[model samples]
Target: MRSASPAAPKQLSLPRLPVPELGQTLNRYLKSLEPFILEDERHGGLAFQTALNLRKKWADEFATGVGKLCQDRLLALDRASPNNWLEDNFWTNKTYFEWRVPLLVNSNWWLALGDDEHVPLRARENMTDLTPWQVRRAAWLVHRVLSFKHLMDRQELYPETTRTGISLRDSVAKMFNTARIPKPRCDIHSKPPSPTVFNAETQKIYIMVHGWCYAIPVYEPTSPPRLLDVQEIETRMRSAVVDAQKRLASGASAVQIGALTADGRDKWAENLEYLLELSPQNQKTHRTICQSLIGVSLDGPSPTFASVGQRALTSHLHAIRSTHSNIANRIFDKPFTLIVDPSTRAGVSGEHSPCDALVPSMIADWALAEGIELAQFKDKEPAPFPASPPQQENWERLDWVVDEKIKSECVDAMARAKAIIDDSDANVFWFKDYGTDWIKDALKQSPDAYIQMVLQLAYYRTSGEFTATYETALTRMFKRGRTETIRTFTTESRAWVLAMLQTRRNLLHHAIHKHSSLTREATTGRGIDRHLLGLRLMLRPLNGEEAALFDDPLFSRSQEWKLSTSALSAGSLFSGTGFGASYEDGYGINYLAAPDMIKFGIESKSACPYTSTDRLKVAIFDALAELKSLCLATDGAAISQSQRAEISSHL
Candidate 1:
């Protein structure tokens, strides 16, 4: 199929993400501090008030001086660098690369799209009944990639926009050929090496099937790029899968190069050099896989209708980036993976990093939409489905030395990776009773704020205290901004939770007001967290006591995100999304909000007894019922038992 780029939107119509006024941001910061301030009189006359006041004053003073200066410097940096200052600074944070392990406890993010969208009958009829559905899936994936590339070329792809009209189109590049390469020892104590971003013109992708990898050259040698037809693409992938399966059956030893990619960079680096030593051919193969556009894992023999439990397992494997059992088939940790579990014709998983989950979710949605349309195309639609194409141009299978030592290491690595997957506790809760739209229409509440409040109530019930929770508010509305952590455990939110529990009616309205205000501040880039982070980053290079602000006990405690949350309103694209908890004792909550239902992908550390997904799910439902009852009670109306039963059944 010929490439047809989507028309780019008018650039002037979109506003650049804005930088907030320092004074305004500081005022919002002060308000956020209200929740954390401890009352001295309640705790046996502890000097908590004095400490809180001191910190507040410090924050007030810093906003006028260093914070303002830092903003100016950040602006200058943004202008001076091709990459936005925040983009470079945030991604290069040593804490993310050096301090955190790229394992189950940190770094890895996972998501799966919804299966609700239907494949039209015309597309079904158009499909060659002879070709396997799974094989056709690979072709569809390639078609989606070509479509995305087309949009990227035309710059027609719509950028993410807030109500204020600020756009985050710049971050879209992370969806393609970028790869997160490990540099374990080169500079472990400092910022890890930036991920490798490849030229988009290189339309080449690696296809992984049955623990074997093959390079698929997607673009033809022409002045302007041309993509291969679906039929041609399908034939090549099917042949490669057959060859890989045959090789496996014949006891051809598979070198588990991918396992190293999952390990700590320093260990990976040493092992990689040793691997290349065993056979020089490995280096070429490694480069080929590493540098490809993206990896499409054509998974075999899995049921199409993967339950939330099955998805959790698959997500774990995908998030691992690469493992021994999956072989070193995955090329990049950051780029999107079109993970097709063919037997069930299920969804795809995008590896997080390089970009946020929303971007990939939209792309996956687009891919699915395109697949459906292509399926419906008329048989005489002039689309070429060749019986065969030049085999050499389509695929290449690399050979590797099968050393016993490598084999042993692969087995051990596989065990370790599998343990993390096995130990993981992922509970997918599909709350079909109602979703964001209902909350908005019924209670006049922001869906996000409503959910955050629900979570606060749930956590309170789970552990009679407010933990440091993080809700990622998109700051992409601001220039070079990434995210601002909306501290969900506010005084207002806590009060609302207490009110719901005690049946204290009037406070719920006030809680919604406060929560929505904080959400606005956070989304508009005036949140306390990112501002403080920027100020701290600026203070790092200074040689004075001001540096102590970062070391302050309050500073450390405030940033300790016990519950890391992100809300992706995937529309109909995802039934659920999930990722690893940011903290060992914490939980990672990625949720999808549809019109009538909201599905939650709750992931927690299995080692943490305090965090149970099942308990949290129940608490969430309880909170929802309690809040609705309280709100409805104001009008002297109560939910009927039958309605409650229906809601309970869906959860």
Candidate 2:
């Protein structure tokens, strides 16, 4: 199903992630300080040259002192590590698992799948029966996902490579049958002993319908397991749906055990301990869900919007979080949960600890790439078949026994999740004006760098000051490589923003070029942030003393990440994607630069007085328009001074 051919090399054959040179990291660190120094100069603090000199002095001292010691220890670590020093030592625990927040909107990432052309989006108003199109679509998706897993287990899935033939790390092995298990201080990834090997016992998947959980087998019992056909899976799913409806109609209520996973990590761990202690059946159920191939949530219909743009995309993303009425209908700890609403609108909400979002997104992309009409069941009618009802024994309902205290805690967790959801100001903006095609072909610019400039202009225009910005850069060229931060708010970027405000276009190309250079450095694993992080982490073990370079006030101020952004593949198979803001007053922005349109998913906290998603949207629009005009006017012609002045006035 992958776009690549099967002859690609295996991931284990790739080179190990290397430690950046100590001197190289130090030089880059000093360069990154320029923006902060400039800010201090503008704010009437230290003069620019004096401040730069002071920072350089600190860097030079640290480079020879504690920094050198940390670099030596890091080199030792790199040699000791089998795959990646960062992943083996620091990344998973420090970056994700040790964070105590609930995973719902705070840590999990969501991807909105493009609508199925065969099942058009329709109003869910007063719809009572389950849409056959929805079930069929869900079945088709499940089949494709399992097929992807099959390819992965068989080592047939093509390994991704850079244009220059460098193989990217393959993380598809971690994409299924994995769950983030909560512990006291740090969570752990629970996976099968041989995660990459296909196991018949774990080929079942859990489906949630009407707040009830059902475990249904997805593979036939045989020597070489065969996947169930779409009709078989759909029948099993329909039986679970009908059974759940009947149980609810008869006044049976689930204990809402799933909500426990959405609570704070420590609390969730405590509750899980108590829950397992209550009964062995509960422990078995938990293990079953954890080891399942994947989770599917057959959600009720989503709210309809007037148009299929910002509002519709926003609603769809919000629903995928299972925040309101369906809060208990989700296993948030699952590595990836497939959510399908009525009318077959679907997306994926995934736990962040196992692998990066891009890993699971690859599966989603492949599954959605081919339409249902091309599947084996193409000849079947879109309507539900009148076949005999599924056997009740085919699936088992998972139930939990809970005391009054546990019930009360579930209520508390649900309320906390609701409050967080209510406070989030999130929206999707479809910038249809133009996209990477025009930027690359017409303006001869790197689309990513140009967009980073647009973000700089937008943020400065909205807040009157530039702050730290974060963009994700993949380091998958190495074994077990994950990501490195690309700081987007550089000194050159700041200058370009100022020039844009003054209608001076000379600095535009410089800013974009700098951004592209930084991006290249990050992707090749010469990034400054991760190296500094490694050094800082090594200090306590190497020596008890702290270093002045890391202790400087500007150091913390420069890494606030007020603007957290990332871009995926062109995302023609996805409507949008998003994650929570890194800071309360900041914005979390994810975008897809399609050929002709760019889709943006922006999130901020409404509780933060300094942030407004709508205001930021307007600024983004204005910035894009202005950048287009400026590029067009300056691309190939030399304009007269009066003509330039006229354009500046309009700008």
Candidate 3:
């Protein structure tokens, strides 16, 4: 009953990330400002006008002028380097993954792969079917992922396109040969910024098995890079795993150098220099590890979904990292990583830069779906092992010169990393009652808009007020673009949530439409949030007076996101995906919507008083229940039909 594979999607020539018109951005900014401006401030007309005019004048004059100059600079960088603008402005300058928290602080995702027994998922709410995996199956699944990597490298892999035909295929290139390199020095005054390097030509993967690690290259270097077959891949993996476990059993001292990557930027810089200064071989070894295309960790074992996700999320935070002293033995800062345990064939853990969550989500989704299909080959002819003699050795164990300094720092880094993991809490749950298709087909509403409404209602019911909410809207419609924040806690949304709570059906549809409209604007690259931030970054050094807008009380308050949520629907296969909250007071919720179910991964600082993932889960369910009841009660209502028509017309 399985369907035939679809034809490959054609790549699109998308336009570059656009700069918003100053006037449009200012108007949007003022609209967002309304909720934050107090009743008292509204009556104090002079002060309000002064503040408004000050922001307007700055946006019109300095911000626009400087924004243009920065845009030009970014354009020049892009011209020099195809995707340099993204790296230079955002990833290079702003993303200090090293300087921030330890490795696990804000950069990892634990994913459970799709299983073949569809009946189990159809039956159980707790999803008890996805546990107790075997080592052979796990190894075979890893080979399946490797095959995916081969397709990805050749650019033959299916490119993801939005319903309206925006091709996101180009972003896949970043998923390989991308890594974060540590700074050479620690001092702010002395050390220049160290950037992550991207080199797709380095078609190699780093594998961590047991407590040991090895680098394995994919190509045979036959004029054009020839990919190794699944048999060869499995052979290499088995050998490597055996050798790794052997070393561990023999009680060989671990280098534990991966700990340096988990430390602060300055500390990492200092340790990196010390490491390089130790020997020429050390430098070569370090480069080999940092520049690899991706990492594949063959973890030991786990029994359940919760056990696997928790083990991957927490253990990868500091355990595998600290235990594997050398970067070669540990997972480096690759754009893509596959952390698979032999015990549980289905789950994979991913670690990457904070902003690039979508890349890993894509990889995970593809791997799980493809993995299931490949598993059907259990009764068929097995893939051939090495056809002829293996060309060149693909695996190498790193030699490290570990000292007292390295050991001391590694211990401290592990402690700090563990503290971060300990302070954070994650909750994973599934809303099996309904999903996107149900919302669209049954209720006749924009699924995304409906979900956003659900989030708004959940937060309102829990907190008793609308705090600033941020929903990441993809602006990849433009070339070399990243993301723009959709200010979800708008006046319309607030009104809608209030009305929805009181079962006031009249305002609910209007609110949903308005929310969808704002989301559309952001999607089209007309959002105010990022434009304003870009302008501020451009004008920061030159104008202190205008820069005062950033320092303003109201401006600062609005920037503090109380409810930070982003959606990644990687079909029904992916049970959940999540990241940490940006601020301590906020809750970070990443929701995955399938055809008939929705999975939410709620995360918050355990210390935060206002937010509890458990309570939020309850609120979210309640909100959905209330909304569903409203839809049923008003099934024959004229407004529902008319509003659906209006929404359909806009689409």
The TM-score-based order of candidates, best leading, equals 2, 1, 3
Q: Write the per-residue lDDT of candidate 1 for residues 383-499, one digit (tens) a residue.
A: 333444345645788655667777776667556665665556666667777777778898877787788878887887897767778988876655556676788876677666655
Candidate number that wins on TM-score, 2 or 3: 2
Candidate 3 per-residue lDDT, tens place, 63-171, comes to 4565556555544555665543454464434544424444454655555555444223322233321112232344455556656666764555753343222334556
Give the alpha carbon lDDT tens digit for every residue of 232-254 in model 2. 88777777777777777789888
* TM accuracy, model 3: 0.79
Task: Please say which candidate is ahead in lDDT: 2 or 3.
Answer: 2
Q: 1 or 3: which has the higher TM-score?
A: 1
Candidate 3 whole-model C-alpha lDDT, 0 to 1: 0.60
Model 3 lDDT-worst window of ten: 185-194
lDDT of 3 at 132: 20
lDDT agreement of model 2 with the native:
0.81
| TM-score, per-candidate, Cα-based | 0.81, 0.92, 0.79
